[model samples]
Target: MHKLLLVMVLAAFALPARAADPLPRATPESVGLSPERLARIGAMVETEVREGRIPGAVVAIARRGKLAYFEAHGFQDGGRSKPMPRDAIFPIASMTKVLTGATLMSVLEEGRLSLWDPVSRFFPAFAEMRVVADGNPDSTVPAARPIRVIDLARHTSGIVYGNRGTTPAHQLWQRSLGGYSRMSGGDFIAAMAKLPLLHQPGTTWEYGLSIDVLGLVIEERTDKSLGEAMAERILRPLGMQDTGFVVPEGQRGRYATPLPKDPVSGQPQDVRVGLVTPGFEGGGGQAVSTAADYIRFAQMLLNGGTLDGKRVLSRKSVEEMTRDHLSPEIANNVTLTEPQLTNFGFGITVAVRREGGSDVLGSPGMFSWNGAYGTSMWVDPKEELAVVFMASTPGLIRQHYRRVVNALVYGAIAD
Candidate 1:
């Protein structure tokens, strides 16, 4: 019986991956993972839910190109309603940047775009930009350099998230936020042009509107919306059907919401924007997806840009994306990154772990990104592993779960 089951599982993995249904399933042992260790993931999550640390969560782990562990814990509403479903959608936030990166790289593969190309090449508004002088928003100077396409991908561009600052520059950028939910690509660029950048182009690794500007570039090049272009190039090809800027009308019930309030402070937590985005397709955030849909994306990266014989990008492109594009000479490349990714370097829309410096256990080349609304995923090439953790904790609780999955998942690896 054991031989027969193993044979069937291995055979199923041989088939091409499909989107409409779950990926081929396999026992954790079949993939060289300890079943006992893998169960710890569910136990930890359930304890978190019972203790009011989180509402619910859906975790999916893939190994050897097969689904070795997939589980949902708690319910959509504090364990009152239906238990979280495997297909429940979560707003992936900045995880959306990777899809945009993949889409843009696909364009680069066609030789139509170059990382070195200046943003002004596509949007004339950026032809000349300014940099804030000595922390003074009112005093500015002409940009020392042009914002290149690569700067946007690695987030070295001077732009920043308006909400992250209080200076006049950030406030200037903040005023544009209310309109993003309905703004268009051309309008977004025009709005950004009037604001002073926080750093010179390619000077600092501050997280900001770099990808949003690149989204406009995508629209200009494809004559389609950012979501549409991504769908045609990467999402559709990889069978990420549940990923987009908004949930389908029918899938609204499957969307996860953060707790009504922070567990500690008891302050109301309204994160409606965390799950569903309407209007402008901000590449930096404002995106939604499901664990099932996103794991295929991670697997594609692990598979070196192809899955089930369908090639979305070349291996060279994926390698370039996962490598540390920053040189040691770039002063703020490692330190200035928002949230300070310990022992990690900024990759193309992802974080690349260096050889040492992180307290966590993982390979040196592992690449990952997480959303603000309690979603995280990482692909470790050395382990042939991809893990996607979904939840709507939206506070410090989200960070706790991220570490939980990282340690437990890696600990479960037996081979």
Candidate 2:
């Protein structure tokens, strides 16, 4: 009898304790945030929707590894008929760069490539690149040096989106866009090589197609498409099941929609229809994700590059990626049309606090980035916090939404 009792006791002792939920929920007060203040975030978003500024939004906040608040406001379309679900998928756009950055860091951790490696190492044509002078594509000078891999990650590669400004490089970029959607990764790189750079590599910070080039680099290094590489390295491991370059037909119901027309421009808002599958998956943009999925990604970074005991990157790699990689000269030269008061990191934006005044609110060392659509996220190491704000408004109004969300989220911190 004693033997039987001993056996039962041993079996009970050997049983594992209940595993914690993958994303545990908690109250704002329990997480050192105020419930009343956090509600203001919803209130503000609600007002924006009521006023017809944005169609709808999903705002999520997590602190100290616990989800404190997550709410959806307004409708998925301008008609105010279809309600927005908390899990509605929105086009993450440029926010895809950070995921690409993380995927590249995973490759870097494997010693497959170095940040200092020249772009010519993968594409030899980048070695003999030229620079256009004074908005004149006709008057060009030989590039002093090859564009480095780091230059692409940090937007220092002098590659600009032709659609952005009116410059020689801009015009060249505009011309290149005509066939951008049809080109393979190799063809895209070849086309970019033929165009003169806007500036010498590592000299200036021009937000452009640099990350897209980095995406091609990943494909060259891994012998896989960018989407495939990211899935193997980032999405699957992070359990971001809903995030990808394409939303399947069955999942299309969850896709968010923007207003029929741009609120400001009064033109039809260019909405992404169907799957965004391309010959080469763009690292610059063209990805869709949900707030829940992205907050997990953000939490992984906030937790020092690991989440749920899975190590995506080393703490050192996270630090290097998030720290301001821009030189003072380059930073000073940054003239963003948006109201972001921040500096560029490798693939994210680092919010630096000025002594006298600033446009946005939050602690310094806050690392973040936003999509061209109304999607923004930030990981505040100081506050031990992360926030993901997702919407589908595709216009300059996104900047205002980002700013308002930032201010309201910061103000909600009772602690």
Candidate 3:
């Protein structure tokens, strides 16, 4: 009689599920992610939380097609103005390159563009390119080779952000006050054409407006704007609802504030709203996304360009997109020499699986990149893992979050 009563009591409490714990499997034990390790990651990042280095941050990691861990720390704004939510929107800065690269790869699959095709073939301005001789501002020499789409993808096209020493190209941009940093499509192409090339094509790796220029090339070939092409080819296909150059009116509330180092002024908030002009030309720097939204895109790449039954790229194309395309000699200049980092692949930065570089359990062929506004992500195909870290602050502050998160996520992989 006593045993039967106990069974009935358990059934009564379990069957009438309360809203508090409706889904038991959503818990760590049911999903297989070690809660202890997840807590450790939170604790590590919390150190920054206490120091007030950032207003807030969101970190999400996925393994084997499942969300292994998702957590938020700190406030979405300073003074604990708003609690950080998991679905908060971030500008995603140059992390836009990954999506832009994916769009190019899809176009390549459709035979609209070839990696080796010279940019001049599509844009006449690239026809008479010249390299800045001896780093001289006025000196110029003809390019030994043509600028190829592949070179742009790998950032080996000799294009750099700021020439730093008043080179011809640099002076022209400064003189014109041209917005190469944010320019897109035809105008962007025109501005680049008027300026001199920084170096011979494929001669060195420098991070600059290469991807933005590639966005123009896509526009020229497709005859449609970069926004439309990316929407039809990449965003819609991935079901990345929140991923776009502009945020919808109703969804604008989800976007987080972007600080400009003034803790009290609160001057430039919500970087996505008024700063980035919404159009086809902003593809390289205009994207806004949430952690959940980007994870789907990353997972698609991990799953051979298909996610949730949506196919975006062929297996061969995916492999080609992630492979390192730079020559070994030029790869050394890809990242800052002080960082002493890895090489650059076609559209993504490659981590050469060094034994001592990062103790994380990433695959030898892992490739990923970050945005200028503190958004960083990486895909380790060999390990079948994808991690996306999104935040709203700018500059090298992202380096700390990138390192700490990777250490915690990869360390808990249960190798």
Count of backbone clashes, every candidate in sequence: 0, 0, 1
CA RMSD of each candidate after superposition: 3.1, 5.6, 5.8
Query: Once superposed on the true structure, which residue ranges of model 1 sit more than 4 Å away at CA?
Result: 1-21, 274-277, 333-340
lDDT accuracy of residue 411 in candidate 3: 68
Tens-digit lDDT track of model 1 for 1-415: 9999998877764534444335677778878899899999889988888888788888889998888888888877644467888888888878888888888888889888899999899988888899999888789999998999999998888888888778787887788754665776667788888778888888677788788888877887888888899999998998888888878788788888877888877888866653445657888778888888899999999999998899999999999988987767554444333243577887888889888867567889998888888889899999999999989877766666777689999999898
Residue 82 in model 1: lDDT: 72
Question: What is the TM-score ranking, best to worst?
Answer: 1, 2, 3
Model 2 spans > 4 angstroms off: 1-22, 331-337, 342-357
lDDT of 2: 0.81
How are the candidates ranked when ordered by lDDT, highest leading? 1, 2, 3
The Cα RMSD of model 2 versus the native structure comes to 5.6
On residues 183-220, what C-alpha lDDT tens digit does candidate 2 reach at each position? 88778888988999889888887888888899888988
Error of 1 at 370 (Å): 0.3
Q: Estimate each model's TM-score.
A: 0.92, 0.91, 0.85
Model 2 TM-score on a 0 to 1 scale: 0.91
Q: In candidate 3, residue 332 scores what lDDT?
A: 45
| Model 3: CA > 4 A from native | 1-33, 163-178, 181-184, 259-280, 337-340, 343-361
**Which candidate wins on lDDT?**
1
